[model samples]
Target: MTAPSPACREDVRRTLAYLTAVGYGGTAMEVWQWLYRPSRAWSLEEVMVALDAQVAEAKVDVMQGRYALAGHGARMADRHERYLSSDKKMQSARWFLRVMRLIPGVRAVAVCNSLSHEMASEKSDIDLFVITRSRALWCVRFFALLPLSLLRRRPGHRTRHPICLSFFLSDASLDLRDVHLKPDDPHMAHWLLSTVPMIDDGVFADCIHANAWARELFPNAQSPRVAWYRRLACLRPLSWSLPFWLERVLEQFQLERLPSEIRTRMNGSTDVIINEHMLKFHTNDRRLEYRERFLSLARVQK
Candidate 1:
């Protein structure tokens, strides 16, 4: 391979540093796919050559075909173990999506966070981003939580591979830039890019179109590859056609029953948003923390 240009080498190092901060590594193709170059797209051969140059300079390490920071080569082993755990969690997520599909108003369901990145640990609960019909947000949340609560598969009930129904948005409100942490939020940008849709009734494309800002952060990143099993469709419509008044009734009922913690935190900020368009119940958001860590690591490499 020809010697990589200085700009290509810097881009490769920054990408590896970001991944290292997130507790994982990547293969050559993975590096190219996740490459952090907002200005221009780089070819796979360019990224590979840059990675090879970094390895030669003792700035990066490769193990079993995976690349990491110089002293973080062990992350490849951890990543492999987490990949196995992620496979099992994905199987469980698929089963849960089948059940969710039976409910009304569910427009799209995508796996997010660690699981979407294929880096979930054994204890990591499955995190999902759901999209419901406009004005049916609260009603859909009620039904979606009902079955999981009864089966003891929710976060507090199930210790291993539990499901976390934290974030939800209505189809009318697909742009997520408002919920981001102000000026520059790298984590949220990557999160939006990483979501893997399990059940999409044409809403996934709309959602992506709504958040085109993510392309500015990762110009070369493509939409996540949809698995064959995740292509299931909701053939028969059910109670989704209910009147708007009933939706308001269900919304009030669910609001009253919300846990005290969520009630107190509701609408306080983006971390625990609660309204008609979106229902995000994350009491402990870590986007700021991850952003800081990534910046710190990237600066050190520079």
Candidate 2:
């Protein structure tokens, strides 16, 4: 077998450094797929060989089957334990999202961020990216959160499981690049490419097609895997559709509860855009902050 090149070793090193900076530790195969992009293609065996060489050179460290920077051997072990805990959390989340899909107008449910990338910590929220029908946004959210509200994980309370319905979009609003994306937004770009669809309902693929702009920034980002689709069970159809008057009533009720500033942002727009497709509860959107942090670290690394 041919020895891995200097460039290949450097790529592997940089990959580990970046991932470790974000508190994500990976196995050789995880690193391999993450490295499997359009710009710098590496075969599974090539990645494995490069990883082994890096370990030999004291450039990378592996602990409990997880790999990280040479200085983070102990942290990698802790991360591995968290990864194991995350597996059980994912199972519970899957069950919740499964029920969420059965709600009327919900088109898809996807696991996003750290969990999707397989690096979730013990306290990582179960981030879900949802797609809903064009006009049933408020109704969809009300029903979707009805059960989740009971299990809010309480502020500052500890729990191995917590569901975060942070992001949502309507079928007609799938093209988020022009609407939400900013230049050099690595977190958003990586998020688009890494979402794990638990309840596709065919809308997940459409969302991807609509967001082709991500390909320009992250040409090497991994595509959505089909294995998640095969596991979805057919949801039972809702017995009765919400009448327009009832939806309006619910929207108004919800509006009464929302902060005045957020209501001002709504500006009386209550259809799929404000009421259904655009329900974002995470006030502190961290994508920009994370992008700036990662870019600063990358520059320092160079």
Candidate 3:
């Protein structure tokens, strides 16, 4: 119950900031450079600076390691390490998206959170905002991915908004096969029609180019407004069921399209949503006991 040291607190802040900021799942030194030389370019010397007394005090949770990239430049870097630079992240994301797109069964990917690679905190897992080409495939991906390394919510946050890849594919309320248009869900069609090149089989370059344009032109576009609002409300962890049920009810018209395999998972998810609705309707005064325990006086002081 003792308070965290001031240096530890600063380290915690820096760690959170750096993980999201850099986001390449790097070794210790790579993260160090991003934090220290946040504004200016960094040399390996910046990495060494962290070894100093006060500076070292600011990296209590960071793993200790010597810099192998001491020679020079970004590519002379270690083979095994994954360092996420701003450009690198985009390139990496586009690569995966293109790969997913090319996969035979995958119709189109309705990207969500993982594309941007939200800042990862300690114990934070990756979240992929995905939409499968088909409901059978969606079910396959869901079950295939159920055991994968993933986390829904950030540690210390009560929301069950997991960091794992979650789907908003084939609206359970709509038919699965109908929504996607050869990787184009309206906007994607616009992208293919306008920005993407009709290159050889490798539409990778085309996708990258189109994605850039989409990001630039309609940067804020996500899902439709009502659906998005319901999604936002449902993932909040507590009292999630009500909005979830309402969302299902709104979307139920598409149920005829739901595949039998995906139907199983959908049923479970629907029930959870219904539970949340019931909780919201029935519980007059819901006091979450864990919130108080999770935020002790020591944590506040720290």
Which candidate leads in lDDT? 1
Model 2 TM-score (2 dp) = 0.79
lDDT (0-100) at residue 56 of candidate 1? 93
Residue by residue across 50-132, what tens digits does model 2's lDDT show? 88887888877888887887776777656656667667667767667667757877787888877876677777787888877
Q: Each candidate: RMSD to true structure?
A: 2.1, 4.4, 17.1
Give each model's clash number.
0, 1, 15
Global Cα lDDT for candidate 1: 0.83
Q: State each model's CA lDDT, in order.
A: 0.83, 0.67, 0.30
**Candidate 3, residue 67: lDDT:** 20
- Clashing residue pairs found in predicted model 1: none
lDDT by residue (172-278, candidate 3, tens digit) is 22222132223223223222222211112222333344345333323322322213322322221111112234344533533455445554444342221112111
What TM value does model 3 have? 0.27
lDDT of 1 at 192: 85
Comparing candidate 1 with candidate 2, which one achieves the higher TM-score? Answer: 1
lDDT, residue 116, model 1: 89
What TM-score does each of the candidates earn? 0.93, 0.79, 0.27
- Candidate 2 overall lDDT versus native: 0.67
| Deviation of model 2 at 18, angstroms | 3.2
Greater-lDDT candidate between 2 and 3: 2
As for lDDT, the candidate ahead, 1 or 3, is 1
What residue runs in model 1 are displaced by over 4 Å at the alpha carbon?
Answer: 229-239
Which candidate, 2 or 3, has the higher TM-score?
2
TM-score of model 1 vs. true structure: 0.93
Can you write out model 1's per-residue Cα lDDT over 1-302, one digit (the tens) per residue?
Answer: 68898888888888888778777688998888888753467889988999888999999999988999898898777777888899889887767788778778888888999998888999999999998889888777888889888889999884688999999899998998888887777778888888888777778889988988877777777787666654553222243545689889998898889899999988888789988899999898888887788888888888
